[model samples]
Target chain A: MRDRTRRLVFLALLVAMATALHVVEGMLPLPLPIPGAKLGLANIITLLAIYLYGFRDGLTVALMRVVLGSLISGMFLSPGFMLGLSGAACCTLVMALLLKYTNCFSMIGVSLAGAVGHNLGQLLAACLLLQSGAIIYYLPVLLIAGLPTGFITGFLLNSLLVHDRKSGILRDLVRT
Target chain B: MTRADKILLAGLLLISLLSVAVLYGRFSIFPAKAEPVQAVITAQGKLVRKIYLTEGVNSSLVIQGRVGPATVEVDGTRIRMMGAPCTGQVCVKEGWIGRPGQTIVCMPGEILIRIEGAAPVDAVTR
Candidate 1:
């Protein structure tokens, strides 16, 4: 019972942090020359949840962050919100599946997969919504841009995991 | 990073470079086809109209958006979004655009207008 409560509180904390990162990342325009490409700083929290909690909790945290972040940004139900939701959904699912089922990749591999899936999902949304082939070039640009950002996300998550390796939660909950 | 991570990263980079080369090759297929500059407009994911932004041209168009109609005007070689039914009317505030690659997008209206060059934009611009 206590373990479950801990998990719940931790999940809530992850969602809160992820939401804050999402909104902040949206505001701070990184020097990435590509228009829509971003740092994806919130993804670190998603990865953390996946590693510590599990796939379901990880997905919940990710989706909740996007929904809350979009609401906070006042872009509710807008195309930007849709794009963000799609990206978050796809990225989280890909990361969870990679870590849970495959187990072939380290945190970095899963992070890279999540980043690539995120961009691809957003592109799919934009293509279907706008119906313009003009944005096709963004596909390649976003894909290339994913590499550096994914590496950063993966690197950060790894460091955080190492830092927390000794900590309370990892020992409190017996991970499946 | 693990060995598998390196492979994935390298593979993604390869695919990105390949797609860029492929797209550039496809766009340059005509090799300087001197077509006139035009602004393509789409609403509800369908092509609404194409306006050639030639000098001395004056026209007004109304495209239906998700909420209501959006007014667009073309004067000389520039096009501007006049007003939109949506609350923000952010598109209306975009003023005017005449350069290639410039775009005006209204998410609520599901409207997209982009200025295109005769050939695709050069590497630096895009």
Candidate 2:
């Protein structure tokens, strides 16, 4: 019971941190050269979730972050909201699944996969809604951006996991 | 390689292909000419045409809906949305638009401002 409680507490903290990072990113006044690119700070928590609690937990946290993050940011139903939600969900799922089974793959490999998937999902959603389909022109640009951002987030997550070592949520939860 | 890795790799490949197809179809197959577009402004499935801004010497402006009929003022290469019944007054705030992809949307009055570029080649030929 103690271990379960501790793990739950850790998960809640992760989710809260993820939400705060998402909101801060949305609110930041950075003049990103591209219209829709960022460091994707919330993705750190997402990557952490994947390493700590398996695929489903990572997915749940990511989805929650997107929905809540958008609502809080007053971007409900806007292109930005849809883009964030779809990209985060797709990326988290793919990364988690790949990492769960593959031992040879490193952080960089997972990052590349996640970044590519993220862009694809957003582009697909945009094509369906915009009807003009002109948005796909932004893909190559988004991929180029996603590659570097994904690498940075993946690297951060790997370091966090390495530092936390066995005391992470995965072990704590498995005890219950 | 495990069955799972192969499956994941295959899925990734499929996603990449789809992305390429979408990018190709959007950029290469479509004409880039900006043309006048007539969009039906619908609220809960009710069609209402209010304001349209197309590029031309003179364009007819319509603002007919539940609120009231408002006069549209046109300047060279631009259209101004005059009076509107919407609370936020975003439609009126939109002032003038001459660009190809500009828009003014009044949710309350179901008014939409659409800007289109030169007529499509097919339309021009016809």
Best by DockQ: 1
Model 1 over residues B5-50: C-alpha lDDT tens digits?
8888889889989888877676653243466889999998999999
List residue ranges in candidate 1 displaced over 4 A. A167-169, A173-176, B26-126
TM-score of chain A of 1: 0.89
**For residues A40-83, could you state the per-residue lDDT of candidate 1 as single tens digits?**
99999998888877888888998899899989989888888888
What value does the lDDT take at residue A94 in candidate 1?
A: 89
Tell me how far the alpha carbon of residue A104 in candidate 2 is from the true structure, in angstroms, after superposition: 1.9
Native-to-model Cα distance after best TM-score fit, residue B28 in candidate 1, in Å: 7.0
Cα distance off (Å), candidate 2, residue A64: 1.1
Model 2 spans > 4 angstroms off: A1-3, A166-176, B1-126
Pairs in steric clash, model 1: none
Second chain TM-score, each model: 0.67, 0.45
